[model samples]
Target: MSNLERDPQEIRCGTEAGERSEVLAGREVPLGGPRAMKVSRTLPNVHRRMIGAWCFVDAYGPEVAAMRVPPHPHTGLQTVSWLVEGEVLHRDSLGSLQRVRPGQLNLMTAGRGISHSEESREEVLHGVQLWVALPGDRRHVEPGFEHHADLPVVSRPGFTATVVMGAFGGALSPATTHSPLVAAQLAVDGPAEIPLDPAYEHGLLLLDGEVEPLTAGPLLYLPPGRDALRLSGRGRVLLIGGEPFGEEIVMWWNFVGRSHDEIAAFRKEWMEGEGFGVVEGFDGTPLPAPALPTTRLKPRGRAR
Candidate 1:
């Protein structure tokens, strides 16, 4: 996906959000061809900005459909493919091919640039695809991918949190991260207390059931800087946090850059096949890059 051709439903969150809990709404996208997939997009919204290094979150599926995402490109960010259900075959320009199953974390770093694809022939599939912006130092380090079958988990009386990145509850994930952040999947059957880093900003995504003070519909921004929380419910929740990222990032489509020109240059390179290379063993030809903006693309991010 280039910085161009964005689905219009990817709306920016409204600014008139209430202080306590701003329930978010989602938009539907055809991730796998024509099959509609509901994406609860959380970053770039009006209520809040980046939660640490995470700049984009797209929670899709629980619904069934074969996923076939043609080869695409990404840059300046790490793609976190978290599978809650089903399995996906990942292929990238580095020639890395791995099938990610449920409970598995498939992370791809597009430091400079990378071309890749995700496909699943399974009739029933479900998962979430997220993006974490690379800090200034690691933005152009190199392109890499890692598959982790086992990660650190923190358990309480009625909740279990599997650390997808960073550390929580004295447990650290072996997963590579550029900055201090936490991404965990929490399974809850009843009331349970989960610890938090008081220095980190946090949020909640109630995936399966409702948590007290949080309904099942949107991205719930927790009162930041809290040390711990008692979540009472019978569902699954995704907890993400990080030391507030101080850098301003420009995100368009799948490419994250510091400026519009950088995005423009990358888009041109992708279309001309100059920098971003081709993915080996992909199902079909890679999706063509979208056309560049006619006007000088305006940049969006936190004020630096």
Candidate 2:
């Protein structure tokens, strides 16, 4: 899903301090038009720009609506699409067309650059759209897409976890990643103790039902160190974590880059129809890049 905001904020994201836990609540943001579908944006919070390399996160739906997001460009990041309900048809510049449903994954690597469109194939949509800032060494590798219909699942007494991006309880996802990270969807039954990587900082977002000590809106951030997450309740939640990103990033609109000039160049290419290849199949025109902020963009480090 695109950032769709007419005046999107320029986010300077950095690594986590690896100190204590924090709870970041999401704010409601509309996706498109007047009667837009609203999503709760949890990452890139004023208090925290990122949880490891996980830069942006938007959770939406369980409400009735049709989502139509036109072709939008992205650079220096990978898009991770996961759904709890409904289906989304994805088409991209690489000439890839795939329909993603519950229990499936759509991973797009906007290496140097890539463009894509998303349309709801069902009325009620419930899911999260996330972005991982690629490290400098891998940021310009190549633009690509992956549709994983079968992913590893780890079952415990109180919950069942579907590994979406990285590894969990020895179960690893087939989706390729640039850095050491983890993303999983947990279906909580009663009470459970989930292990954690002492080296990777983590964040948990409750999607539905009730997970004790965790409600259905805010993202719970767990800094690296001693492990294990103990929760008692029945609900659904998303867990994402990674080694604290060693580098800082400048995020504007849909693009992620290092410096102000780098971002400016990306915007120029998108508006001029250059770098990012064209995304066919969508009936509507591509989304226009938002205007740059008057001041130069800067990188901010470790949101302590």
Candidate 3:
């Protein structure tokens, strides 16, 4: 299973079984930064699909001001930051500091936890910040860093695909993970359609331009076991989903785990001086406490 290419069918099967909640596009939150940049929180406190093992997605900007934020800390997670327009510099305590421009991707695995900061260069910044939950088995591993520049993008007869993680269209990212997950960027001019594995469930984020959802608007969820999906008009899409975890995942605030008690213990440790790691030369930005759910009950009905 380690070296064999995953059958898209098997992947799709796992996706359906792990099906939970769909993303309801929410209002944009203005992040007061270099230029009062705004952030759209797509899927939170719910299940995320279309990319392998990943459960969260957020798109940052086509910013006019250079946005810079002080370094912060994170643990038991891997952050995939992809620049879409400008350049952003990342510095960490692990002696890893680099500037990433458009088309470059920075993959930071905060195993056992680590602290870091990202800031815009001369002008402004625009990018996507993706958070992928780490399997329980690998959460305590040592931290690591990987960088890819001008990754060989795949452009077939009808679509353009950029594989940021896992394998897609015969291309893959260097970063390894405990689960099978694929993140791809698809751009289409006019109408184009691609076959979907009956097993894999997926979602599309209209990052820029405009796209017509073949199914319908105000979409709640796209089901599994389908032949293919088509997209038309002039626009771009961020396709994310993957095989779902067979077990339940407890997500509180920014922490994801199998046990709420386990996350609570980690949070307690983080609040004290017992940090897992620190970002070198980084002016640590205090992490806001995660907002607890209003009620313990989960929302019923399809995504709206």
Candidate 4:
């Protein structure tokens, strides 16, 4: 399972967001090439490393360019591809070839290990790519992928929400999930009321608009224990949350591992040709692993 495990240190899940709500401005990261794109990373930051079981969050541009990422390796997490505009073609080691479009989802489970590639098919592509760390038991499961073209949605007066993952407003996604998480795409044309999961820590990222009456820029994080939120505006946003990941996890480049040595081993194997074997039919240069930091990776879960 790539040695990714939960920290033995017990951090109580659903820790309150505290009395202060945070407005986070994501760091700008540019993905280069002729088809270059910029993204914002909210999680895994110095201020907050994670929200619920979600450890990695990347909100990419509505850019018009060809993607060049070749088949790459991942472990201990599930990649959730949710597109708000444009399209992405996903190819994985499990022989899954799927095209992700607006309002569609592509979920890849990197249990033991998996390799996948994403290529843009449209002139412009806009989406959010997120990672859900696996629980200890599920981290070792076989690699797999699933696509949900049709998901459940709730339509009210000026509010509409699509339950992308987990159950929301009596709607559930067909895509498989390893943890108790909720991912939804919400749009508000005017005043909107949405139900929230009180048991989870939630956050919102404006794809193009704002949260009603709030003056936040683009991101608003609501700590766990809120029953609902009212929205009175015209915009699009992504709603993501779940039970907080109680354990710690170490991440480097594309791989998430349990320990420093474990991550080093994974990097060595992938770059030195020992792990994450060839993904057939994928023709492109794979991204190289970055150098490990001088300081040891922080421990999250218990040592394997």
Candidate 5:
């Protein structure tokens, strides 16, 4: 029997109810290219505040872009860049330069601060960039880097799951964080249900093909509640969640934090040109200015 064919009640799951929702809305920003732009379509918190500590989710570069962003600064948050297709070269002020392709995960914990930039080498670069809000106590800690070459990749029946952070089933990632979170990807087809825990908040992005609740349009945010969810139809899906971050978090552009003042200060520093303080070991150039939005931060109301 396929792993997905097993009992849905017993399958290990995240804390969020495994429910599906329709892709309701999306916001797209043309990132200099006529076609290549930043799309904030997924993530329930995209237009608002944090849903369980996950903030500032962006999916870009399914198309070609002539321009690539240079080195930029970041502070008070952990930045994650995962590729689904194409390539991205990341250089930081700390002198770390890494070329990441698909199946590779780049996690930067800017505890105290750091500066970095992702430049696409080819015409097309597509992937997801997530900004995870750090706890106040760990916000100003030292910076670090964790890259996995032989990370565990598990396949079960209709799906393949990647353990990028925290733990999943019996496998676990080496990366450490203050919260209990799991980053996963699912590639599947036909009708199937994914069982999840009731304690964790969850969200899913349909990378290709289509599914109920989440059409191949935008990101779907699933609130915490039930223990299992069934995704019918076919295609591939990327799921990420864990214990819902209970803290109230705020997000503005690429910055995420628990307090508005902290975000404001980050803006002041960013405007003043103070990016995340890079590590001392990586081989790279200094940080550059961020690709700021054309307008100030918009109020997206409350998290659902």
Candidate 6:
């Protein structure tokens, strides 16, 4: 989904030191207008910015609501769409039209630029929309889209892990990733231990039920050096991590660029219908880019 805020804040993101585990709570943000659906934004928090290459994270509804996001532009990022409940129809500039349901993944690579829309006829929608900041070398690659209906699943004695992206439990997902990242959905039945890569910093978001040492509405961030995670509870959670994103990024509205001039140019291109192509199937008109801030955008290191 797009960052529909009228006055979006510019975020300068870089790597941070995480020596220990921390629980970071999310602030609620509305998606669109007055009746917009509110999502719990956890990734770009004040306490922590980027978790590896995984930059933006928004977890939304198991409640009754309709999602109608108009066609919007994106660049220097990849959108990872995962649903736990309900269904959503996705339309993009590449002429790809697909419906993503629970257990399925919709990965869109907005390498240079791309436009897309998401709509759901279902009464209730529940899912998480994530953005992976593309590294410097691959940021300008051609944009594309992928939909995976069957992903690898690792079933242990106490839990079942669905590998949404990257490698987990000796199983790897087919979804393409630009970095050494890992994303999985863990359905914990009782006590379970999850192995981890000591090189990557990880974060866990509780989706449902009660997980020991983890409550809903907050993300549990585990810094590098941990080899495993132990949990004894019945619940579902999303685990995401990777090698810390080393480069600084300026994120304003829907575009992720390097500087204020670059972002302003992107906005100008989108407004003039230049780089990001037309999204054909969406009924509504494309979303207009929000006005830039009065001052020049500045880059800052990661939040610690």
lDDT of each: 0.74, 0.91, 0.59, 0.73, 0.59, 0.90
Worst 10 residues of 4 by lDDT: 1-10
Q: Which ranges in model 6 have alpha carbons more than 4 Å from their true place?
A: none
For candidate 1, write residues 1-304 as lDDT tens digits. Answer: 2222344222221112223434445444456455544455655565565667777777776777777778888989999988878888999989899999988899999999998888877556666777888988999978999999998888888899898999988899989999989999999878888898988767788777677756665676654558888889788888888877767666766787877788888878888887767888875877876565565555444421
* Stretch of 10 with least lDDT, candidate 3: 1-10
Which is the better candidate, 1 or 2, if ranked by TM-score? Answer: 2
TM-score of each: 0.90, 0.98, 0.78, 0.88, 0.78, 0.98
Better of 2 and 5 by lDDT: 2
Model 1 misplacement above 4 A: 1-21, 301-304
lDDT tens digits, residue span 244-286, model 6: 8888888999888788999999999999999999999787899
lDDT of model 2 at position 126: 94
For candidate 3, give the lDDT of residue 185: 75
RMSD per prediction, one decimal? 3.2, 1.1, 7.8, 5.0, 9.3, 1.0
Instruction: Tell me how far the alpha carbon of residue 279 in candidate 4 is from the true structure, in angstroms, after superposition.
Output: 2.1
> lDDT tens digits, residues 175-216, model 2?
999999999999999999998999999999998999988878
Q: Give one digit per residue, the lDDT tens place, for model 3 in 159-237.
A: 7878777767777767676677667777767777754555555666676676666321222344566646777776666
Q: Per-residue lDDT tens digits of candidate 5, residues 1-304?
A: 0001111111111123224443435565555334445554445333333445555556765776533554455555788777777877776666777877777778887776666666664567667777666776777877766666556777665566677776665678776666777776666666666756577666778777776657665666666775766776666677776566545445444455545466567757766765555434434543323343444443333443
lDDT of 1: 0.74
Which should have the higher TM-score, number 1 or number 3? 1
Q: How many clashing residue pairs are found in candidate 6?
A: 0
Number of backbone collisions per candidate: 0, 0, 19, 9, 17, 0
Q: Relative to the unseen true structure, what is the C-alpha lDDT of residue 190 in candidate 6, on a scale of 0 to 100?
A: 93
